[model samples]
Target: MIIYTPPKPAESIPLIDLGPSFSEDLAARKAVAWEIHKTARDTGFFYIANHGVPQTLMDGQLDLAREFFDLPLEEKIKVDASRSSCTRGYETPGLQTLDDGSPPDLKEGFLIGVDLDDDHPYVKDGVPNCGANQWPEQPENFRTRYEAYVDEMFRVGRHLMGLIALSLELPEDYFAQGLKEPLFNSRLLKYGPQPVDAAFNQIGAGAHTDWGMITLLLQDDVGGLEVENAAGEWISAPPIPGTFIINLGEMVRLLTNGLYHANMHRVLNNHSGRNRYSVPTFFDPNYFYEVRCAPTCMPENGKPDYPATTVGGHIAEMYRKTYGLAA
Candidate 1:
């Protein structure tokens, strides 16, 4: 296994530009990869600028999300996540507890994945997280804007997969094969201000590491997201206009044999009486794809920490733990 080295001190998160050139020129792409590699090894979190996602698209998503979350409790419950065949519906506050033994998170969420019908090949084959999406009828333009945003994020996610492969010193397209028919999960989250008394244990979200390969997040100007540095100090990852926050997840850390840090992070509810909104798209490979240590990540004269496991199983177990469905 690769050894872990603690960061010397906390520093402001870096903002990198991932423009069209990143995917256009091979040499430049590798240079970019080296930069990402260093950042991943240190913090696994960075802000990406010039990502090509339109400002209007981002605005549309946030607008639609606010509209959905503002609906009456009864209206929101109509699409409750508990009703989904696959986790593709609305989740009320306190439904997820990311930090084991701590109070549940004080945020509401709406999760959507690769939208597929019952007749789709994957769904027909009984693959998990490949069912139809739950829709809200009140917002006339929600479906259109939401789907458009998801499609764009999916494109960016796929592009980042190649960059990550290059960063790991593997063939740039090494992850391409695995991502064929990949499972992409996106969540729209709303964190409202909580009273000081209720905020003791009811954090906006609890400290935890993400379970997927990578996550691309879009957050509004109202800041609250925090990431723990190697030195154990929590640092702010506030909103950066025209950029998306990207972070490596547990799957990547495991695949890299711990060379990369999948740092712990948590969110705080706004106390200014305003709400915080974020959209996080989880880019994961096909459910059945087995991940193992990459060649460059194997420790000298040693083996990987563990054998390969299906990405789906690893993610599902974490889901169970967070949702209190684990036995």
Candidate 2:
């Protein structure tokens, strides 16, 4: 019984480790995928185990994340989002701007990527990954390490798509063609020790569904993520030390005809005076993918009223809004 509860902190829900999910045998793999699919379709969220993300790598990333944020304010401000495309740059506290009518987010972040090109329609400025990257000169290996992580994440993210397709009873390569030359955006983020608000809602990020296809998240020891369930109920999402939290994003939900929902989630900034850092490598459809209904996803007579849209076009609009450029 998936009840539609109001939005708030979750009481309790069984957390399952994602280990033993990937099997060499077809039947075994399908079974694991289905279990995850059922949970995702039912709650739009879940804890993951056997996700194959290394603890050392995640810990190292966290340490470097702290180092990156601890740099002098002047150094941090050099690559501000205002100076790049795709909003890649450093954003300090009170810099968060979202559609939700909440106070400033209690966090800061550094954004980067390399998807920009003169021919790539998404690029508006020199920044790649939607804009230009803010490379740190002091940390000689920062870019290399982050890029390595992103590559590994992308590798894992692609596998997840095949599993998702299998769970939906679709072809294993269902999402492959469109993913060639895809526009990928990975976020290196940090949260915590933020200003308090009178309303008592200490928002690190707003309550919103990810606008992409899927998100692979790497979180540190401190946890404060919450996702809205089927009944619109909030469920606590904590750190499991060595797993990547994967969630179906809105585009995937739409592509699957809502079989998997893009859950609404947010970060709560109440960490006993400790900071939280999260890194997510978003796996998105290549811009050219025509995000339309498949026979398996939608019946001939059950097509959605909305017109079909390209994967890139829809994201471009969302990107504009996320960066306050949308009209």
Candidate 3:
């Protein structure tokens, strides 16, 4: 059973300055990688500053979310997620339950990914979560702005992956092959304050680990995100202006052979009174990329705890479990 717990101030989640990671100096980049290595080993969660995404773009994305969510229900539902084969549209509150045995999440969201046409090979072959996005018509320039934001995210995500390779003592381009044609799903989520008589364990988003390799999250100032520490205590990850929260995911754990872990986190907007907004981009390798234990992560004498899996396969299973869809 899931228990709702109030979180304490965070003491272990580190705030990492990513400026050095973008430096031309190899030593400077390696220094940043070392810091990431330590944090990933201990907490699997951190905040990144100097990430290079323009302030205007970030603010505009948030403004777009507010504008879209403010649309009338009738208009928003016109592109309902259920209507899309790839789940690239709006989802109503309670549509997903992130934590097993807990009440459904108190959040509504819009999901989108790399836009593809009906004739695209991936779409024609019915790749899970791969196809054109169902865009809303009311929000002017919504698609144009969001597409630009996604491009910037892709840039950051790829750069971080390079750092991660270095952190594992491998060449910077170790994951380059897999990333050649990457896949990502960006979600714009809004959480209203939980009701006074809400069900037990009900919250904005349930306690759960992310499904992909890494998650880059932009959260509004009215913070409610909480991450579970190694000791199982919940600590608040309050919003730090100009920084984005970065968290490892299950796939990363698999790659590192448990040398790193995916920490559990949840959201509770109770104290904020007003609605909370966040945008999380789930960055991953190409759908068919084989995820296996990295050479540096191999145990001295034992095999990897997890078996190798394909990126798309693992994500498909996770989606099925969370959305209660048939296998």
Candidate 4:
């Protein structure tokens, strides 16, 4: 059975200042990378400040989420995720069960990815989660604003990936090939206040590890997110203004041959009468990019613990498991 200890205040989760990373000096960039390397090895989760994304853009995205979720259910469901082949629209609460054997998550969500046309090669070939998005007619400037935020997120994601490579003592552009035309799934999630009579193990989001290489999460002030430390204690990851909570995913664990961790996290919006909102962008490599252990991460015997897998294949498997979708 799954058990959740009440979260204590965050003490070990580091807040990294990324300003140095954006500097032209190689030594400054490497200094930031070194901090990331230590954090990745220990927690696999950290908060990044001065990430270069504008505060206005960040606030606008959160405001948009509130506006979108405030719409009448019928209107919100107009562009239901069920209507899209690639699951690129609104999903009602209880639609996804992130933790196996637990009740479905208590959060509503909207998902979108690179806006591709039907004629695009990836769409034509039926690449999983790759296709046009199901946009809502209501929220007048939803598309334009959301897309703008997505563009900035892509930029930050790429830059962070470059730093990740440097963390592994590789060239900054080591993952350039995989990053070209990368695949990403950006999700806007809303969680209502925790119900008084909630079921066992029920929460806003379930205890689970992300499926991609990295996730950049922007959360509002109604703190509820929690991370499980190496000691199995639950630690609160409260919102820090102008910062995004960054976490490594299963793929990173594979890439580092288990030297780095892919920590388990979950959310519980227990605020008295308020809702919680968060946007997490699952930034990953190209769909077909092969994933394997980095040379520096290989074991003494020259054998990796995990087998090679493609980005698309791994994500597809995760979707099937969590969403119970057919292959």
Candidate 5:
């Protein structure tokens, strides 16, 4: 059956008051969590206000990200992604993509996973980011600030995950088990508008969903991001002041047995003369964690599309496709 598509702006963006509601009242928290559920199931992405993150810190992170992006190519390459199996270094614009059989994405990213030692459980046995970050010694404060921000993002991300668990009526800290030493990633992304004369120009980032459970995004005002809704309409997600855009990802869909969704999204770059920067925190469960159809997700009448599966095994299959991991 054909579905009626909603217009782009039809997506509802609820500004949650995180101060008293999220902290004090049980019903308040559930109400906020339900909002997340509705938005995730209906559209897959939403902007959050009153999220409690400081605008000053957000600005500080953006300035640092842009500064890194503006550095000379050679300097930035000191931590190139090719050096690691996880693709955790600087990506030149057009090096990666998720478009439907299209060319690579036209954006650069500096990727990092959770900070941990060599013995972290998530990093063991053919997983990425089991070691310390490769820092650029030339920029003295770069490592310091970058690490701090990523850490904060991880803390906040896990907190939100707990709320999601509560909304689902699962264990309050369902994410805690897999996240004891979570395999989270924070990317400093830059979107540069291309020159008209340039021969092979394209959009900033191709349509794709996060591989992790969820993504917390911070973007400057110049917006180009869009997500597809249940009605198959593409909704533009513009940048809002002091707010973070949250998106459901593959892992969450898997964990919830499709109760949540991993939405399709893309970035378009007009010939407008502007540069945009965004930072996103990607919270992935431990590489080996089994992501499956929760028992609570099934019922007497309806069975699952697939059998219960481990999170690690599923992610491994995806890695094989993306990074050529051994079967």
Candidate 6:
């Protein structure tokens, strides 16, 4: 698990077309894998185009997000995350602090995970974060639309994971084996525009690396997302119609022995008068699955920079710190 940081990060993220992988031609699939390999190692961030997800469905998610945020503060708090044992439901602004000394993020969000029933084995077993969703009654179709989108996104994520496996020179199904009952989640966020005189640190999100395998983000036209380069410069990642921004996470970096980049990133306060909306889906392995450096990714020395840990444990520790629950 040798760590190899790039000397300089790319100024622009690679735009990859996944259409080739769907073909039966082996060469086409290999070509896609090569492209993914380069961009993943260079920046750990890229734009995916020609993905199977319908544009209409993507638009529908944004509509639902705006509508949900428009509800009165009282209605939004009805299913607040504080009421749930897992990380689901509405999250108020200034509640999540990404950096130790940075001001709480100036954004509001809603989190959703695999919708399980009380009778589900995980819920029955008292698994952390395996609870039913709390849907608001007013937005009658909100739950349905969100769940539909989640299913579609999950499908795409699994497909990408297979491609990632191929890129790593492993069997295509390698990751699928550990993804049974994955610990994934999706978030709907709204960042209000900041005042001209707002403090420099009043950001929508502070600099931090994602804790899971990967993240797929769909952003609105109003841009604010920025990725930090190796030189520590912030690169703006504006919204690109019909494209989802994909980035590797810490888990991928750990598993790849640092062949992939889990680059740090943050969001600036929305400067546009209209609220900025985004949907980011996190893809992870099963909660109890143990992760380690892959044989193909390890160097000759075979020394791991990170120790082995369960997916659930990694997430719990991150949550404890971010939520101020850690001593």
Candidate 1, residue 56: the lDDT equals 92
lDDT of 2 by residue, 288-320 (tens): 678766557786788664467776678777766
Note the Cα lDDT for every prediction shown.
0.86, 0.71, 0.90, 0.92, 0.73, 0.86
Model 2: worst 10 consecutive residues (lDDT sum): 123-132
Could you tell me which residue pairs clash in candidate 3? none
- Model 2 stretches with alpha carbons more than 4 Å out: 1-22, 117-129, 197-202
Residue 116 miss distance in model 2 (angstroms): 3.2
RMSD of 4: 4.9
**Which structure among the candidates has the greatest lDDT?**
4
* TM-score ranking, high to low: 4, 3, 6, 1, 5, 2
The TM-score that candidate 6 achieves is 0.94
Q: How many Å off is the CA of 260 in candidate 4?
A: 0.9
Error of 2 at 260 (Å): 1.6
Q: lDDT at 43 for candidate 3?
A: 72
Name the Cα RMSD for model 3.
5.1
Give the per-residue lDDT digits (tens) of candidate 1, residues 220-243: 999899998767788999898989
* lDDT tens per residue, model 5, 209-262: 777778889988888888888777787887778888888888777767787789
- List, residue by residue over 3-36, the lDDT tens digit for candidate 6: 9974566898889999998888877888898899
The runs of at least 3 residues in candidate 3 whose Cα sits more than 4 Å from the true structure, single-residue gaps closed, are 1-10
| Colliding pairs, model 6 | none
lDDT for 293 (candidate 6): 93
**What's the C-alpha lDDT at position 34 in model 2?**
82
lDDT of 3 by residue, 143-165 (tens): 99998999989999999999999
Clashes of 6: 0
